[model samples]
Target: MKHKRSLLALPYVGWMALFVVAPIVMVVVYAFTTAGFEPTASNFTGMGTYVSIFARSFQLALIATVICLLIGYPISYVMAKEGPGFQRVATVLIMLPMWVNFLLRTYSWMAILENNGLLNQLFDAIGLFDLINGLFGTDLTYFRMIRTQGAVVLGMVYNYLPFMILPIYSVILKLDRSLLEAAQDLGANSAYVFRRVIFPLSLPGVLSGVTMVFVPSVSTFAISRLLGGGTHMMLGDLIEQQFLGGAYNPHLGSAIALVMMLIVIVCMWVMNRFGQGEEQAVVL
Candidate 1:
């Protein structure tokens, strides 16, 4: 039986070795080597020039993650507390945008947020711009909503908000009802019960949602490119430029990727630890 089980696992092991392990190994090798295949650390050393890009990526990602949490948590909690029919309809609505292609969804946002796009056209039709100009005594045509950092963050939020919602919803929906009843029996009010019992138990889901949202937001290129119009270049775009753009430097790209991976790993570790601590405190 043991030998048979080992044989059964061979294909899975081989798959990981070929796909996951091999790519990671290649990235590590390229990250530590020069274009000539000679070992060198210059690639990492040169990263000083892109500090602002890294900062902006993390900042925008953090903002988007926070927005998703603020918006998703309440919705998730409500869904968890609602009837089956309501939950079903809410779930479908939340997931409807995801059924469309990601690029198409982003393109739709472009049409909505562009200077002379649908939003501005609506504003013009409604005399909103005219009202603002009249009050301010200034001539105004359209608001510059696209091609800014705010637009990039908005794209990230729209694209990744569902990721934050589903995890938290699943977790909240699965909470033990007996515990909530016990808290109530102990004279805990709704707000107290949530803060003391519900929120603590939901830490794992929150952490998962944060990880899901933050990772992609931090590494996104297309959203920043299309929405930000190359003005707010992120780490993902910077890495792409090194390998595929005019820069043509795979070594530097690999180094940046490796550093980003390490940073994400550390962040996840910290979040997990914090979640565990919160859970432990709740249990006590």
Candidate 2:
């Protein structure tokens, strides 16, 4: 039985080590090495790349994460506590947008945010046109949504909301009914119970959701390119630039990839440590 079990596990272990561990280890090492695969002890280059990614890449991600949290929390809470039928409907509604091409969804924001776009038309109709137009009128501007930070957040939220919802819903679904009942019986109101009990127990799901949204939002290129336009750029776009743009530098791209991994790791650690609630981490 033991031998057979080991045999069964062999392929799984091998594949993980090969694809997951190997690639990460290689990237981490290469991020520290000199370019052109000619291994060197040039730690200076790696540190410099790391510093650059920290300052720029993380700033965009921070903005996107804040946007998702401000928007997703109430929505997730509603779905999690609502009737089953309503939850199902909300699940579909939230996921439906994700079914479309990510690039298309991002580009669609352009039409909404562009100069002379739907937003401007609506603003003009509502008598706020002069205020908006006077603020920073420019024929070539794309500020309503496109070529702006808001557009990028919109795209990231649209694409990654499911990530936030699914995990949170999973945990909230399995929340201990008795504890909530006990809290209510013990003279606790809804808000107090939630603030003290329910939200506390749901830390794991919150962590997972935050991680899912923040990690991808930080690295996504399509949203930035399509919505934020050429003016606003994320690390993923920077990585693409290193390889595909005029400044084709694979080594730099790889270095950026390594930095991304580290950022994700650090974020996960922070969530696990500081962001977690006092109560035990709940599971779905």
Candidate 3:
């Protein structure tokens, strides 16, 4: 049985070695080497020029993650407390957009946010812009919703919100009801029970949702490109430029990618430690 199990693992092991390990090894090698394949640290040292880009990426990602949490947690909690029929419908509605292609979804948002797009058209039809202009004594044609940092954040929130929701919903749904009842029996009110019992227990889910939302939001290129209109270039776009764009520096791109991965790892480690502390406190 042991030998059979070892054989069963061979395919997965090979797959990881080929896909995951190999790519990571290549990235590490490229990150630490020059274009001439000579070992060098300047690839990382030369990233000072892009400090603003890094800051913007993390800032936008954090904002999007916070927004997702604020919106998703309440929805998840409600779904968890609701009936099976409600949960089913809500789950489908949440997941329905995911069935479409990611690019297509983003493109749809681009259309909606453009100067003369559907949203602006609707605003114009309803005289919203006229009202604003009339009140402010200014001439206004259309709102510049697209090609801004706000647009980029909005895209990140829309694309990744479901990731935040599903993990929290699953975790909240699986929470032990007896514990909630015990809290209530101990004279805890709804708010007190949630703060003391529910929220503490949901830390794992919150952390997971945060990770899921933050990682992609920080690394996103297309959304920033399309929605931000080249004004808000993120880390992903910077990396892409090094490897594939006019810059053509794979070594630098790899260095940026490696640093980003390390930063994300450190952030997650810190969050996990915080979550563990919360869980321990709850246990006590």
Q: For candidate 3, write residues 210-273 as lDDT tens digits.
A: 9999999999999999899989999999999998899999999999999999999999999999
Lowest lDDT sum, 10 consecutive residues, model 1, at 274-283
**Each candidate structure's count of clashing pairs:** 0, 1, 0
Question: Candidate 2 residues 169-252, lDDT tens each?
Answer: 878778989999999999999998888788877777878888898888888888888887867767888888877998776666
Model 1 CA RMSD to the hidden true structure, in angstroms = 1.2
lDDT of each: 0.94, 0.76, 0.95
C-alpha RMSD of each candidate structure in angstroms: 1.2, 3.8, 1.2
lDDT per residue for candidate 1 within 1-284, as digits (tens), equals: 99999999999999999999999999999999999999999999989999999899989999999999999999899999999999999999999999999999999999999899999999999999899999999899999999999999999999999999999999999999999999999999999999998998888889999999999999999999999999999999999999899999999999999999998899889888888887887768
| Of candidates 3 and 2, the better by lDDT | 3
Worst 10 residues of 2 by lDDT: 275-284
Whichever of 1 and 2 has more TM-score, that candidate is 1
Query: How do all models score by TM-score?
Result: 0.97, 0.85, 0.97
Candidate 3, position 193, lDDT: 94
What is the Å distance of residue 95 in model 2 from its true position?
0.9
